[model samples]
Target: MELDDDSANGLLRSFGRQVQALRIRRGMSKAELGAELSYSQSQIGSIEIGRRVMQSDAIDRADAVLDAGGVLIAMKEQVERAGFPKFFRDARRYEAKAVELHVYATQAVPGLLQTADYMQGVIRMERPQPPAHVMEQHITSRLERQKLFDRDPAVSMSFVVEENLLRRTFGNLDMMREQWERLLELGRRHHIELQVMPTACAEHAGMDGPFTLMETDQGQRIAYVEVQRVSRLHTDRKHVRELELKYGIIRAQALSPSASL
Candidate 1:
């Protein structure tokens, strides 16, 4: 489960303190711990300060290296979950298990497609902006989602993005070019389809707003919709079916993958 930001920050710092204490009790310096973990002293410093998120393997190594006796290991899942906003945690879980995902993105480029620079740019522009630690975690967690492409049974994915959204200069010219290059590279993948909804289109089916239709590994279909950071995963068959059909229409109306690229 995802905790509120304050709670998450508290937990992360608490965990960091525990790791720090264990290191000190072992009569070891951060450099020594990093050597054992094959991480740099700076990386160890970041983790110790709760400013960096670590992977499962790194946690295991840290657990063994710091002699924490599974204390740090036990906090693995919970610590990672804190990186995401509470409203989006459930959807993030299902998305990881998805066998098929179709995204209609109306705002910025969908998370799965965003370049790191583009992702950071959008996060920084958010209202009531997140603190530095939270912002780093946000980018890390979202980037972690891209690992879906590396899964054993890859998730077949498609996206229909607003053309105007692509035209927006999220950063300077170089960054924009990099983002477009990233998009073009992704569009070349066989299992993935990328389409653009041109502003010139007179007939549009996605006007109701952006939504994601996902089919899980078990063949269960679901729909995810979010607005203002409030996210919903609709598992009801009726609603999921409606979204599936709506997505078909949106794809039909959008420019083809080749044209989009």
Candidate 2:
């Protein structure tokens, strides 16, 4: 049977969720789990959420820890060349109808809030160094993606950003200031929410890195988790429930919305 984009995306999400469920069942902190597998914490988190491909060794370790009985073992090979980042393509499908979006970012400003120039600068900094024209194409694509926020009945969007991201100059001081201003402007929008997880938040989920929760029109929900150069989408019902619970705890621990600025 052929799968449409949505169907394919859903399948990937379900896989991601399953990985997360196993992680929790094993009661392993991301750091501890990554250490056991000789991967970074981000790598462990990414694998669990299906944002990054599972390394063979890591999968073996996970199986051992969770006593998976090879349930997750078979999936390792299938996701080795999963084509796209976990949530990258799937996010576009639901952005239009998303009733609510909760995002946490520790590295940089959220993509939707990024300007064309900022994106170009980022693209230029990639290790392989995309050609100027290619970089421009990426900039265009990213900026165009931001237009969804302009839709009527506007999607409810909230962002929790690490305080350190605010001080790092992404493009230039002017650009950085513009980014902050853009954030403030978006927060002023009736449908949007902006918060900051302060450096003094006593270590929370944001410390584990960044993730996103998106609610679709039919009320189905999913989590999108990202790591360096990769992303994952998780929609397994059981996994979604756990991440949602953790997200709630993190939200409560982070700085208040008004105080975040």
**Tens digit of per-residue lDDT, candidate 2, span 1-261:** 234435544554566677678778888778886777787887666555544555445666777877888876776543332422233655555554587888878887888888766766666677878555334434544665576688776778878788887787866888877787888888788777788777876767645678888898899898887776676778898987877787787778777777765
Q: Model 1, 137-209: lDDT tens per residue?
A: 8887788778887777667999999999988997798998999999998889888999999999999998899
**Candidate 1 lDDT score relative to the true structure:** 0.86
Displacement of residue 31 (Cα, Å) in model 1 is 2.8
Clashes of each: 0, 2
CA lDDT, every model vs. true structure = 0.86, 0.68
Which ten residues in a row are the worst by lDDT in model 1?
1-10
Per-candidate TM equals 0.89, 0.64
List ranges where model 2 is wrong by over 4 Å: 1-87
Pairs in steric clash, model 1: none
